[model samples]
Structure formats: C-alpha cells, structure tokens
Target: MRGNLATSLRRRRRRCPIAQYDRLPPELRRWLAQAALPWSPVSALRLWHKLLDETAGNIEAARQRLDLIEARMLMRDAPRIWGVPPTVPPRQPSPAG
Candidate 1:
C-alpha cells in the first residue's frame, strides 16, 4: 500500500506541471507542447520565441501589479473586474458599438 502511494505521488508531481501547462491559454499550450517535441531546429527556435513573447506579456501584467503596490494603492484603489478596461479601455475594445 505504501509503495503504491509513493508511486502515485511521483506520477502526480510529473503530471501536475504538464497539467498546469495544459491550463495555459490555448496558443501558449500548443507552442509549449510542440517545442518539447521538436521536428526541426528552426521550428524549435520559433516556438521558443513564441513562448518568450507569451511570457513577456505575463511579465508586463506582473509589472503593472507591482507598480500599483509601489504606489501604495489599496484594494479600493484598484478597479474591480480584472481584465476589464477603465475609461480608456486599457488596450481593450469599448463595450459600446
């Protein structure tokens, strides 16, 4: 029983990371999986660049949150409904037609 439990744990650890990768937005997940299974050198490199671009976007989002913290912004200071744009729409299209 104990041996089986340990084996299950090991499998879970390996599966968790891949599962997390699967949870990523569709485009990133596709590139990441294909990057792991490279067909050609050029393809691998291109996938790496695509992954980097995705990470860069996430980094920018983190930087924005950090900026808010640095400015001593509190909960109320931040707007509700994350991913929703403010008055200028913050890179998002306006709700109106």
Candidate 2:
C-alpha cells in the first residue's frame, strides 16, 4: 500500500495550509483526519454543505452519508488501482424517509 502511493497519479494542485484547516468546522477536521480518501478542503466542504442540507444539519447523519459516498468511490476505484474486481455492486444511498 505504501509503495502504491508512490506510483499513484498525482494531481497538480495547491495544498490547504494547516492554519486554514484549523478554521474548518471541528467535525469536518476530525472526519478529514480519519477519512480513507485524501479529500481537499474545497471538495469536502462542498459535499459537507450538501449533506447538511440533505440531513437538516444532522452531523451524525452527514458523517454516515459521507461514509457511504466514500465507500462507493472506493469500490469504483478498486479495480483500477488495486486490480481487485468488485464482488458486488456498491450500495446506493437510500432516499431520506
């Protein structure tokens, strides 16, 4: 896994500074720290805002929704990156009831 990262496609982009990261919501900071994907602040914030709107600002719900999204992304990338075929279709998020 460590060796794979060295050969992964690198995106040309500026990085968010630690001070700027400190200004993000504490919950988001925590989530980013432990997230499976290396999400940029701008992209994550955009999704976070969308989740907040969808969940009526429920932080836990937003976090769970984010996890579902990340899982789908991982499943989509697994074949290309790890040469592992997906055993099952990725689960779609259920409509909010």
Candidate 3:
C-alpha cells in the first residue's frame, strides 16, 4: 500500500520520470518521497493530476492534509466511538400497584 511511513523511511524512493519529480517544489518532493506508495505511477500520477484540478492546484494544503491523515492513522489504536448510548427501560414498580 502507498504512504506507508515505515517502508518509505527504509527505502530511497524516486518518483518515476526524474524530470517531473524534479520540477515539483522541494517540500512537496520531500513529502512524496516520504509517502512512497507501492502503486503504479500511471494511476497515482493521473489521480494527482485530477486532484490538482479538483482542488485548483492547492498542493501545499493537500499535502498538509495528507500529513495530518498519516499522523492520525499512526496514532489510531482503537475502534471509533459513536454518539448516543443505548437507553434501557426503568424497572416497573414491583408487586405494589
């Protein structure tokens, strides 16, 4: 899977097409390098292109969201909690009325 922090840390990753990778701003390049997905470039590159269009090319903020998600995933260790505990009926008054 892509964006696995541990594997990325152990590998020296290069995005396919060095020129394209080189053209990215330094910080974005660093982030991608760290993210290092195991996916094929065809899909991921095309998806990123589409996302850039969808977000109007706000790359930095998207990267920030990625980082936030990654951090939260790392910290997540339990099932998610939900609102509204179940209600139980009060016991009826015993033999009296």
List the candidates' TM-scores in order.
Answer: 0.22, 0.68, 0.35
Task: Kindly indicate the candidate among 1 and 2 with the higher lDDT.
Answer: 2
| lDDT score at residue 15, model 3, on the 0-100 scale | 58
Pairs with backbone N, CA or C atoms under 3 Å apart (clashes), candidate 2: none
lDDT of 2: 0.89
In candidate 3, what are the lDDT values of residues 1-97, reduced to their tens digit? Answer: 5567657356777756766666665655676778734333444456566666767888876676656655665446223443454578999888975
Clashing pairs in 3: none
Question: What are the Cα lDDT values of the candidates?
Answer: 0.46, 0.89, 0.60
> Per-residue CA lDDT of candidate 1, range 1-97, in tens?
5667656445533345445555555544444454423233343335445545755856445334334433453344445625434565367666996
Candidate 2 local Cα displacement, residue 19, angstroms: 3.2
Compared with the true structure, what per-residue lDDT tens digits does model 2 show for residues 1-97? 5866687789677766766678779999899999999987878888999999999999999999999999999989988999977479899999999
What is the clash count for each candidate, in the order shown?
A: 0, 0, 0
Q: Model 1 RMSD to the real structure?
A: 16.3
- Of candidate 1, the 10-residue stretch with the lowest lDDT total is 36-45
Error of 1 at 92 (Å): 57
- Candidate 3 residue 63 Cα shift, in angstroms, is 2.2
Superposed by TM-score, candidate 2 places the C-alpha of residue 73 at a distance from the truth, in angstroms, of 0.4
Q: Judge candidate 1 at residue 25 and give its lDDT.
A: 53
Model 2 reaches what TM-score against the true structure? 0.68
